[model samples]
Target: MKERTIFQKFIHTLVDILVLLSLAWFIVYSFFSLYRVSGHSMEPALSTGDTVLIDELSYRFIKPKRMDIVLFQRADKSYNMKRIVGLPGETVIIQNGRIYINGELLETTKISPIALPGLAKNPVELGKDEYFLIGDNTDSSEDSRFQNIGNVHFAQIRGRVWFRLLPLRKMKLIV
Candidate 1:
């Protein structure tokens, strides 16, 4: 009887562990996604072939902030990664190879001069649900400056990229 009771306890413990693990797997699978960087547009920040983990839950509770690297779907239903530059209700214009927000020069770190202002040569106004995104490598990026990708709607954003996971040695939190 003693031996049978011990085996039953062990089995119960095993079932509890399995249940906990299953719950954990479900949460991670639903709330996180992996994205692989594909081009030089985000160079000097995220390189091609670098894998990153995206948090799909945070944006549901809070709005995305400027400088946040995000994964959003384009009009053609393709995904692209970029940094948030201009937010809702703001006017953005690129002139003299510099970016101006609300008639003031925008200051940022590590951003290169714009070679082509594209549609932003004229002031581009953002709506309440719109966001202007740009790649870190301005000259090489096809972003809000172009008509096709003019402004990203909040609903089109997939998630915020927060961690770099691949190329083991370079693994770190994406700021």
Candidate 2:
């Protein structure tokens, strides 16, 4: 066994503090992370393998709005990147490949090249803490229009997409 000198003891304490601080920082930063797209759910706007920076802090100040791209947890334990189509307390209807909110057409430019395959027959009304989401690739995406992923509660949302940071030529803020 070796006895530590006073100087060595001081250095050990300093190292311990530094390590703790670094760990805390890493944990906080990971919560606001850059997630990479793996599927074609958000094509035209976000292609496969595109990395997006998620701003987890924005929801802290304001609620997510319609057409805002969001990141949420899926039932299968994977993260889903989708666009908000209906907010809390709103009625959403998808008919004839068009989206209608509160019986009026939605105004947004996030749709993919393909037209949606029509939505569920009934209108979906979001609850106080629920949000309706859908992918840009409406024709193929299984989102809020589907029975499995209809309305996402606030707690399941991670954050809004800030911007894309890969494939330089296509890099741009999430519009």
- Specify the highest-TM-score model's number: 1
Model 2 agreement with the true structure over 3-62: per-residue lDDT tens digits:
568778889999999999999778658757888988888888888999888889989999
lDDT for model 2: 0.82
Query: Which regions in candidate 2 have their CA more than 4 angstroms from the true location?
Result: 1-31, 112-119
Which candidate tops lDDT? 1
Q: How many backbone clashes does candidate 2 have?
A: 0
Q: What would the per-residue lDDT of candidate 1 be over residues 82-174, giving only the tens digit for each residue? A: 999899999999999888888989898756788999999999999999999988899889899998899999999999998998989999998
- What are the models' TM-scores? 0.85, 0.77
Candidate 2 TM-score, true structure as reference:
0.77
